[model samples]
Target: MNITIERAALLRSLGHVQSVVERRNTIPILSNVLLRAGDGELSLAATDMDLEIVETVPATVGRPGGTTAPAHTLFDIVRKLPDGSQVELDIGGDGTILTLRSGRSQFKLSCLPVEDFPQLSSGELKHNFSVAAADLRGLIDRTRFAISTEETRYYLNGIYLHAAKSKMGSLETPVLRAVATDGHRLARVEMPLPDGADAIPGVIIPRKTVTEIRKLVDEAADRIELSLSDNKIRFGFDSVVVTSKLIDGTFPDYERVIPVGNDKVMEVDAKLFAAAVDRVATISTEKSRAVKLSLVRGALTLSATSPESGSATEELEVNYAESPLEIGFNSRYLLDITQQIEGEGAQFTLADAASPTIIRDVADSTALYVLMPMRV
Candidate 1:
């Protein structure tokens, strides 16, 4: 196999594909990336059994063939090469060694047979659709923070993506939604259903896949192609493709956890509220990370107390008209949800100190958050 490619182009594609290869692999082939030189282009692919990323970049192919080499080693070499330099990759008759040359620097890397690499067959992806890059980013950013890290309840480890009927006034409107929860806080965000997605299966995208896809979305085109089945999902950008296995467990019925009877309403500037929480949380216990919100007719007080770290309190005028109430929550969780609010104000609906609280953005109706209260 032989190929001559621009250093920058090779580096970019390598960066995308190498991240899928795990740092430590039980199988030797899994540590290598497959590089194939074809008609005027080079394709790079890497996988860690469950997640695979393939990217194609234009190159000057001297000979059409393929080889597999250490993903991280090749990426580092290309990254260190001079800017605008041309990279030449050549494999001899034996095919056990790959020679890389850029300018005056040269290195030889051990190669593995391309035939040994495993492929994750996408199978027949019956459901296919395209979503705008902005919409896709919104769906991931607004809900990914709530994805659980616990391994025991593996189902909640990724975003639950599906089509649902959202109530619009007196009508039911079809929408695509992403929901994530960790038994402490829940985030549910939705957008108008994309074409050909109404029948898409309810799939749990693993957290690792979400992280990898989100990183590439910024570099992707204006629209991204999505294909899925019951157990697999794929996202295709212009020059990149990511295919991943769906989590096998069942996600709990999250709708039952969203409180419907919370009537005590309060509206506060999200920025101000977040700042108050941050300042007060400085005195909170490290184990609990708790901050108490004391709400009254027209004001809210954010306070935190720790027997060893001391105590702190901050007051802010709010739009609450309901009865007085006090609720405790994890300060980190509170800041995470408030940071997602794009608008100036965040509205909170409360039933009491013990029941769950519902929070929403005043200007955006498509996103909702539910937080379970803690004992102060």
Candidate 2:
């Protein structure tokens, strides 16, 4: 195979595809990327068995052929080349050596047979739909922080996506929702259901897949194409395509954890509240990172104490007309949820100090967060 591609274009495509390849692979072919050049374009593909990313970029093809080469090595080589340099890739007649030439630099990389590389077949994705990139980004960014990192509860290690009916006044509207929880905190975000997603089944997208797709969304066009089945999900963004296997476990009934009886309500400026919490948390114990929120009818006090760090306290005036309440929460968790709130104010609904508390953005009704209380 022989092809010439711009360094920037090749570098960009390589950056996208090489991330899927693991640093260590039990199978030799899995460490390489399958490169096929033909029809004035070059295709780069990499897979880690469970997740796969394939991208096509325009190239000047000299002879149509294909081979497999080390993904990371090639990426590093191209990244170091001078900007705007033309990269020429040539595979030898014996098919064992692949040569790369850019400017005055030349390198030879070992190649594997294309037939040896495995393919993650996205077989007959029955459910298909399209979503705005902004919507998709919002769904992932807001919920992914809550995805569990524990391997034992594998089901909670991904975002559960499904079609549900949301109550708007007295009417029900179909919406696509994404939910993630780690038993400590939960995030639920939704948007109006797309036209073709009405019958789509609930699927848990693994944390890794969520991360990879989120990166692609930044460079993606206005819309992204989604195709999925019971066990697989595929995303298409212009010339790039990503396919991943769905998690094979069932997510918990998240609705059951969301507090419905939290009557005590308080509204506080999110930025101000976050800053106060940050300052008070400086004296919190490193292990617990606990901060106490002491709320009265019109004011809230944030305090933290530790044997090593002594104690700290800060006060913020809030719009709270409910009865007095004291609650303890992990300071890191508070910062995480508050960062997601785009609005100036955040509403906190509390049932008691021991029970879960619900928080929502005053400016955006589509996102909700439930944080489990921690003992101070």
Candidate 3:
């Protein structure tokens, strides 16, 4: 196979495919990317068994054939090449080596049979829908931070996506919601449901798939096409398609964890709240990193203490008319929720010091967060 592709175009496609290739692999073919040249384009594909990414880039094809080459090595070579250089790839008659030439540099890379590369099965997807890039991106960015990293509770290691009836400006509306939690904090964000999405089955998108799709959506100009089955999901946009296996576990009942009748309410500047938590957390012990919030009639005090280090205290004016309440929380968890608030202030509803607290953006009703308080 022989093909000539611009360095910039090749690098862009490589950047998308190579990331799915693990640096260390038990199977030799898994370490290589399948390259197929035909019809004035080059298709590059890489897979890690659970996830597969395929990208097509326009090129001048001299010979139509397919081969596999080291994904990372090829990416590095193209990345270091001079800008606007035309990259030429040729597979030998024996199909054992690939010769890459650009400018004055030439390199021979070991090749593998493309037939050995594993392919992701395109199952019969029961649900198909389209979502704007920005809407999908927003849903992911708002909830992914709360995805659990623990391997034992694999069910909590992804975002729960489903269609539900939610309140949209006092009217019941069908909305697509994303929820993620790590037992410490939870994030829930909802977007208007697209047409034909009502039949979409609920699926837990793994953390890795969420991250990869985010990257693809960032570079995509057209609406993202989504197809989901019981065990897998696929995303297609532009010249790229990503398919991933879903986590085979059930997510917890998140609604029960959310506080319903919390009466005590307080509103504080989101940025100021995040900054105060950051400042007070400096004196907290590394193990705990706990910060205490003391709320009075119209003011809130943030304080942290460590037996070995020191202590810190900061005061912020807030709009609180409820009874006095003292709560302890992990500083990092508080910051994570506050950073997602894009409104003038963050509203917190509390039942007591031990009960979970509800947080919301003052201007956004579609997003809500719940954080479990920590012992200080």
Candidate 4:
């Protein structure tokens, strides 16, 4: 196979496909990316079995054929090449080596059989929908931070995406909910259910897939196409196609964990509260990372203490108190939920010091977080 392509277009697609290939692979073919040139276009594909990404770009195809080459090596070489250079990729006479040439520089890299690369089969997706790239991006940004990295409970490791009844706030009807949790903290964002998306299956999108799709959607033009089946989800936009295997476990019913009838509501300046938590958490025990919230009559006090590092306390005027409450939570979790706020204040509802707390932004009612309390 031989092809000539612009560095920008090649790099853009390579950047998307290469990430799906891991730095280490037990199988030889898994380490290489399949390059297929045909009909005035170049297609790049990479996979680690669980996830696969394919990106296609326009190119001048001198010959129509396919080959497999190291994704990272090719990426590194092209990245270091002269600025704005067009690259020539041609098959060696033996068909076992790939020659890369550009501006007086030439390199021969080992190649593998394209047939050895495993292709993820496309299923007859039951649901097909499109969402604005910006909206999709917001949903990911607001919830991805809470995905669990633990391997034991594997089920909690990815974002739990499904259709849920919008319990409270403006969009009171049923909406699509994106939720993630690591036991200690949780992030949940809701959006108006898309047309024809009401029957989409609920699935846990793996962490890597979430990250890869997020980057794709961010760079994609206009809207992103989403297709879902029983065990797979696909995203395609701007020449890129991503397919991920959905985790095959039921997500715990999240609503039971979200407390209701929490009469004590407090509204405080989000920035001020977050900064205070940051300051106090510095001295808190690293293992615990606990910050205590003391709300009494219209004022809220944020504090954290460590036996070795002393204590910190900062006060902020709040819109609180049907009852006085003291609750302890992970400072990092508090900051994460609060930082997503776009406006001045964060509204938190409490049942007591031990029960879960519901946090919402005053300016936006579409997103909420449920944080478990800690013992201080």
Candidate 4 worst ten-residue window by lDDT: 163-172
Per-prediction TM-score: 0.99, 0.99, 0.98, 0.97
lDDT for each residue of candidate 1 in 54-140, tens digit (9 for 90 to 100): 999999999999999999999999999999999999998899999999889999999999999999855778999999999999999
For residues 61-151, could you state the per-residue lDDT of candidate 4 as single tens digits? 9998999999999998888887799999999577899999988999999999987889884667789988888888989999999999999
lDDT (0 to 1) per candidate: 0.95, 0.95, 0.94, 0.88
Regions more than 4 Å wrong, model 2: none
Candidate 3 per-residue lDDT, tens place, 112-207, comes to 998798989456777899999999999998999999999999999999999998965688999999999999999999999999789888899999
- Candidate 3 regions exceeding 4 Å error are 168-170
Count of residue pairs whose backbone atoms collide, per candidate: 0, 0, 0, 0
Instruction: Give lDDT tens digits, candidate 2, residues 1-376.
Output: 9999999999999999999899999899999999999999999999999999999999999999999999999999999999989999999789999999988899999999999989895478999999999999999999999999999999999999999999889999999999999999999999999989999989999999999999899999999999988899999999999999999988889999998899999999999999999999999988999999999989999999999979999989999998889999999999999999999999999999999999999999999999999888
Model 4 C-alpha lDDT versus the unseen true structure:
0.88
